[model samples]
Target: MTTGTIREIDSASVDADGMLSRTMRILGCFTADEPELSASRLGALTGLSSSTLHRILAQMLDLGLLSRTPGRRYAVGVRLWELGELSPLALRLRETALPYMTRLYEATGENVHLAVLDAPAPERATALYVGRLTGRGSIPTLSRMGGRQPLHTTGVGKALLAMQSGDWIDRFLAQPLERETMYSITEPDAIRMEIDRARARGYATTREEMTLGNVSVAAPVGSIAGLPPAALGVVTRIDGADTRRLGALVTQTAADLGRALRAL
Candidate 1:
């Protein structure tokens, strides 16, 4: 949305429901870049009156929905973990697939991961990445287990892009791609070419496109029981990298994981 329109909506929600507005604002404080927030930062973020923010935070803390950090910063709590653990989909799938992903990591000696496009859910732009593993001296990466990444940039991100319908692909490309790193692809045409390559080869690769000096390969693991296809993959350094060979490994790993998902 336009900056003005988003600002207006943010102001309008304040009048909608005092409690609900504060709750969403609290959650909004955590960004893709920042997973933790101090109460003062949250206050500045939501622009809610401090009294209201404090009360809401207190309630969330008492309920275990939020956890208090060393200096009163708030982070998603173990209660989220407890509640999420109750969801059979998240719990069972991650538990089932971790061993296989671990094996992939041990064998390839690269960061292994699993993720899916949010085709089934429209209200949120989400990627359900089940795992992320990094080794000592591995290239620094921002992706995390169960964390979300933009669909335009990362290896897992491009895998999501490749599975899109032609219309969806067109619409996605019609927008601007953000420049996260000097190596990231900011042009729509380049992303389109990469997506085409991913489609042809059954895997995706990025060379510092998401993070500098880090190269990653991702392969699609198609869905089971109507779920979106998942991306299972690995990440490594660009030095001495053979991207095509890495792509081959990712494709094989993704296929094996897809079979495991279907069997479960």
Candidate 2:
């Protein structure tokens, strides 16, 4: 319950030892890790009677907070996502950067991405918007807007990761690094060495590490001192791309974005 608010009689929350309580308990099972649930598993986890859970589920169904998956289990709803889009920072960034990203796309005809750190869990930075060139077919990019990618084997991910601390770095390498492609880096020591290099160089690269026949150049963008909003990168086809040229361009764009973010 929110503090300092007057308690109302018959509030939406009440003693849940019965059907209503059990239903709310079941609904609470959904997390970012556990985005969906079977009614039986939910009932057991929540210690709700099967009959009560079925009834409470009907209420959630009415509210559109949960929907049936292909496997016929309940999961988070699109409506909840719609609400998150209303967040001020999220809505403002997209509006401000859309034109610039579009202009970059038009000029380069490559894949452009916008990313932001999950401030609370900075290790798992987020990709917010990915812009693809409309006219030309770019190299197949592994990154998608609104999807999560790794900070080790990806251009933007490593760039985003480079801005963080040694503690965060150590935690990241603790996991078995995923191999997106044969070129992906897996050795923890090597990745740490590269992160140090990236911090000094101010950019990162993925040469078919995330996808075959694809390569990318990435740089940090408009990151706050303690928090990086995102790393912006352009992914292009591998052939005929000059490493110096791509790195310079990405670094300049990132600097421009960093300045813009500071103003905001």
Specify the highest-lDDT model's number: 1
Residue-level lDDT of model 2, residues 3-23, one tens digit each, is 111112233556645545454
Candidate 1 clash figure, as a count = 0
lDDT of each: 0.72, 0.67
Residue 57 alpha-carbon offset, candidate 2, angstroms: 3.9
- What candidate 2 gets wrong by more than 4 Å, as runs, is 1-53, 67-78, 119-136, 225-228
- The superposed Cα distance between candidate 2 and the true structure at residue 148, in angstroms, equals 1.0
Model 2: ten consecutive residues of lowest lDDT? 1-10
Q: Report backbone clashes per prediction.
A: 0, 3
To one decimal, what is the Cα RMSD in angstroms of model 1 from the true structure? 4.4
Error of 2 at 183 (Å): 1.0
Q: Model 1, range 87-206, lDDT digits (tens) per residue?
A: 544665666668778877787787787776754323234455656776875666787765667776778878877777777777666666678888788787888898999999898888
